[model samples]
Target: MTETKELSRLKLLAKRYARANRIAQHQALDLVAGELGFPNWNKLISVSKKGWLADSVQMASIEAFVTRALPAAIFRDGDPEAMARRFAHLEQAERGMIGDHTYRLQEILHEVIIAGEGWSIRIPENPGAIPIVETFTNQERECPALEPEFLQKALELARDRAVQVRAEISADWPRRSTKPDQSGMVRHPLCRGESDVWFCLHCDGKITSAQIAQNLWHCPACGASPLDIFDTAFWSDDKGESFLPVKTDGSTDRDELDFRIVDSRPKLDLTEEKIILLIRSALLDDATNISEKLGALQAEISVDDENGVWIIIEEDLWPEGKDPVQALAVAKLLGLEVERLSSWSTIPFAWPRLGEIASSTCDYTQMMLDAYAQYGGSPTK
Candidate 1:
């Protein structure tokens, strides 16, 4: 009975040792398999680095068999100290199969720490208290709810602030040049009826009439409205009119008088609303004649002698505090081409008062005013 009890105790100890050894070996295999991108030990044993059929299974199986047998053999035939040494050898062999790198152990430990109850700890209420490992674990599961009203309000405020900032950053454009030079008239090399035809200022094309009734004429090609025939030189094929002299031919300047109307009006298409907007904007302050104002505005907006006008809107003149939809409607009604400036703060123009800042520390209006004062009221020409 005593012998049977001792044999039973030995068997249980041997089984426990074998189970520990098996677990260690399995862990090592898992590490190697992960490194090689294999799903499990079976796949790892079957496949080689190049993925072709090799002696990997035979090699690993033989290694595992030898490793498992050695400890049992030492325990059965050798002293207690020899068995201990054999267990230590087996542990070293298992670790070697995985890797000798210190980082391997750290990685395994870190994964274990993250996966286990290490995540359930709570953060200390004391501000000065140092964080423990458990505080980090609890944070992973924390999902604090946000108030919908507060979030919506914040988003709206952010949107308004963004618009204000955009306005402040936009560029300031210089006044357009409106010079009545050679560029004002674009001449076509092709003449109408052997006479050089110049572009009519009113019709925006070549004129073809000799009769200047009421000092006004219309374009035949475009059928545009009539224009006033201003003091200018024109060519004609016929010799039967009265006007300025081309040369000092003392005989009543017959050649100049007989000049046929090649070109008549200036090419300016102005709408009533546009004229009003221009007047309101202080762009056309000095204008006894509507035509003169149109001419000047056209010239001021001209960048080159190309005889085209480009109207630019001052940043501050746009409705900042008003409804965006209404503002857009106003711009469209005025018949002005509006472009939203990207960087309003950098634009050369007066910064209009948008609204009072919610915070005293960040007063955007005040900042813009100071910047405008420093940069001067208008953009440099």
Candidate 2:
């Protein structure tokens, strides 16, 4: 049959739909034909040979039918278009109300995020993974997510969005990455590697072509991206002999939405580096003059095994017998003893007393430069 602009557009749409839904091209074409009021694609072509042109109304109707989410059950049935219309009649939405509460839906990185005023729910891309519900405020009694009806409604909305996200991801990948051939061989979208048995570098899992296709070229064991999947175990000495077969038992096609509560509260972990940073900051607070501030900035602080801190200050910058009272107080508050020591090293300038006389670093820098010029030499060569 002669192809018109509308027919070409319909073919392109069918190709896209087939890629996303993981079906054969012929099946997609038949689906398109079914939506156009034909029983099958061959019948449509046969009728078109007798001089028939689709009008704008027919074209718009077919386009609308192909674009929306169609049920997977339609592909398995004898009449795809009838089943498609049935599912479209009961369409789901991105935004809805479960009761008095309202929610909005979004998909990020193939995961669904449903959010409201002070609470949100995240449905993971993996269907086997549990959904996570989080509340922004500490008042759990007032959170709508705590209500059973609201939570279920929100979860279903998020999960529906997640399924769409997965479809988009599958559509973006190469067709072979999602559908294996009769020989159980598929190609990696990133590396373009073709093999019946694939290997995952991230988890060392041996995956079959069917398994790789089912997981959308991602490692089911570790959830690694297609970039990490290789056709051969090039890094292994035994050529994938030691690689274990990845178990996908947890993966099922059920629609059940199980959720888990996660606490995202921040916790402080005190380490040696943190203790040293605190001591250094305290030393800065103890500084009373420009020279002392410079000394504090350059001070070497370390933590000891017995909950003690050793602070080494430059003797040229810090005055002798001037104890760091603020630093000592901070250390005492942290239940740490302070041991102060002095190091005599080559100072930044020739005259150590210049910084002490000046109120700020800018003034001290000018004075030092002037002193150096008067002596017919710069601070450094």
Candidate 3:
């Protein structure tokens, strides 16, 4: 039982490793087994059946091995320890003072998100893409990102997270796709096409193998994800021969942060459909009998461009001279002019007047069924 518990702990560690590195659980398990001096996970399990359990030191070693950035194929030196130390400064629950305001840093969905009281910044997975800084309030204050020190700190935190995310992405891809050869030739992970120059289907930009590798397979020209990049532009008739070269100047670096304030407050828009729905609900509130309720359900309501509501109530279900007071009050509240009209139409039941005479719908239904049986052939019809 103790051995089984140790094995379960190893499996949980493998799951965490798989999630962090964006690899399959089986692949992570094999890597874990390799770290523990086993050839593969199957071999490790076979050995575990012979009464083997991992000690605290061995478990810590396995965790440390799996915690490092995976594959090491993206780095020129192929050193995982150096890669781990590069982002070791950022803690799991990190917070810093950017000017007078405090900002909290967190990694969500492989993106670095730093949020403050009224503003938040999101650094996407693609390194070439610009960081999005959104402000909640509109007090006309100076943008915090415009400050040099604040922007630098935010960029540092974001870039570190981006590097880890890029490493994870590279680990999932083929080694040939991430690392180009001496002749600058690379393989497309999706199409298996090998070429020195690639084409982006999203923006029709021609990309060299080095440029794509530098951008982590994302299109530097349009900031499109790796899925949109292909070795050949199969969609084009000329195979992207006439395409322009993608300009990647300053894509990997940002000297200045663009500041833009967007208002994200809740806005209530009284569209035509919304106005009609509100008016119909008001008509339902005004209904006193089942016949009146059917009249409200069958009412044809429309809103004009001049903020006027037109409602046509059925004359047989609704009274002739009676006005819908609740509907008029609702229209007034919405600052709309109401035009109510009556029309004769076929109702669901034969005796529409019986609904008005009875107190409840059940009594009206039974009374209508008896009337239908006495006058017509059958109530089922």
Candidates' C-alpha lDDT: 0.30, 0.77, 0.76
Q: List the residue pairs that clash in candidate 3.
A: none
Per-residue lDDT of model 1, residues 1-381, tens digit only:
133432233234333323322213344354334434566556754554334332456435333433332222332343546445434443443112211111111112111111122221111211111122222223345311122342222222222222222212111111011011233332121212122222344433333222111011223333333332222334433321333222211111111111111112244665554544553344344322332233224322322233222433333333333223332444465444433321233332233332222133245445656766787673343
Predictions ranked by TM-score, top down?
2, 3, 1
Q: How close to the true structure is residue 276 of candidate 2, measured as C-alpha lDDT?
A: 83
Give the candidate order by descending lDDT.
Answer: 2, 3, 1
Question: Which is the better candidate, 1 or 2, if ranked by TM-score?
Answer: 2
Q: Give the TM-score of candidate 2.
A: 0.73
- TM-score top scorer: 2
Each prediction's TM-score versus the true structure: 0.15, 0.73, 0.63
How does model 3 score by TM-score?
A: 0.63
Best by lDDT: 2
Q: Give lDDT tens digits, candidate 3, residues 145-214.
A: 6567876667656656665666666666776676577787988767658999988889999999878876
The residue pairs found clashing in candidate 2 are: none
Question: Model 1 Cα RMSD, Å?
Answer: 40.0
Q: For model 3, what is the error of residue 78's alpha carbon versus the real structure, in angstroms, after optimal superposition?
A: 19
Residue 302 CA error for candidate 2 (Å)? 4.1
Query: lDDT tens digits, residues 10-112, model 2?
Result: 7888888888767788988998897788988898887877877678998887777565543344476656555544443326455666688777777788788
